[model samples]
Target: MSETAREAILTRIRTGLAQPAPLPPRPDFTAPVHPPLAGDDEVLAFAQSFQGAGGEFYYCETRAQLAVQLATFRERQQLGRPFVWEPAMQEILRAAGVAFQADETEFLAHADWGLTSCEALVARTGSVLVSAASASGRRLSIYPDQHVVLARPSQVVAEIGDALRVMQQRYGTALPSMVSLTTGPSRTADIEKTLVLGAHGPRRISLFLLEDE
Candidate 1:
């Protein structure tokens, strides 16, 4: 059929059937809002949820204690080498006398441990949200044998909804290309219903929750 004839017929058909339909005034989506509790309530919920999902959590101070904690983890796991975000964590590790790789790609390929910061912690699900546009990118969130996150108590929100709000506020319209909500080490029970962890991603996920200020 000729392009002009096809266009004319399609236009006539569309006009014949078209009607202005106003969407039913978007029903009031507002529901009973129960805001998340602050202080220990949210913290406890997050800890319980994260632990239940096979994630390990730890406490750490900024300088000395943080260094000691990392050292202990390395000795215990025998991590081949560490890969960390440059300005965010590499300097801190160096100041603590720990060695790390700078070339993220090469390091990620060989390193067993990968360290980065999180955007926020979802207390309801005990998950950490991260953006690839952040210093670590999505690779730091998933492409490693072990994932270590430095989380502050202030970053913990009552639920995933709150955490997402924080992200939206921070990035505005230009958001990261990738955002990951990780609850624990990867897992799967697809084969014969036998549960297996780290089937798709990191085998180990650890969060060092900094003491509340």
Candidate 2:
């Protein structure tokens, strides 16, 4: 065969061997209504219930208050102190015992845990979705033994659809690298129909509800 023909045949063979599979369809999203903010006592009660399940909850009136609570938790949890936040939070974390690093590489390499703000929470399921585009690494929510999330009462939606719509509007064509629908801690019941926790993700999930602030 001529060199050109030989090359053509080889190219055809390679193409034939390659898999041509259609991509999975994007998730269908339907916006749902926001849920009314849980009463302070109700929120507190929910947190108390999770305590028995190895979870913690904190309530704050403002972002400042939440940051302070987080700092304290990090210290108590021995998750290393945070040094700097993006802006207003940096100092608070530093004071609480967090050591700041220069970049994400350092953040993950040394930090024992992480904290991020959430877009919304589903009151119906008590689930929260954290987006990677929000500058929060997926690992922050998954890799750590403990995950601390900050959510506002106003962001509590009635269903997952509401959260998805907020995401669609925020990111448009470019979806976040990851969207985690976290409800409680990771758990599984695979052995003898026995329930187990922390199978694939954090053993503990903490949420700070900022209502007034």
Query: What TM-score against the true fold does each predicted structure earn?
Result: 0.78, 0.63
Residue-level lDDT for 5 in candidate 2: 100
Pairs clashing in candidate 2? 61-213, 81-97, 81-98, 81-99, 82-98, 82-99, 83-98, 83-99, 83-100, 85-90
How far residue 66's Cα lies from its native spot in candidate 2, in Å, is 3.0
Candidate 2 structure lDDT:
0.67
Q: How close is candidate 1 to the true structure, as a TM-score?
A: 0.78
Model 1: lDDT of residue 205: 96
**Tens digit of lDDT per residue, candidate 1, span 128-176?**
8888876777777687889998778889888778888998999999888
lDDT of 1: 0.81
lDDT of 2 by residue, 1-213 (tens): 899999999998889779676789886566335444466444443454445445566888765676677767767887764322234335434543545542466665665656667767765567778877655556667776677776666776655777899889888989887888887888899989888888998777888776743
Cα lDDT for residue 39, candidate 2? 64
Rate residue 86 of model 1 by lDDT: 49
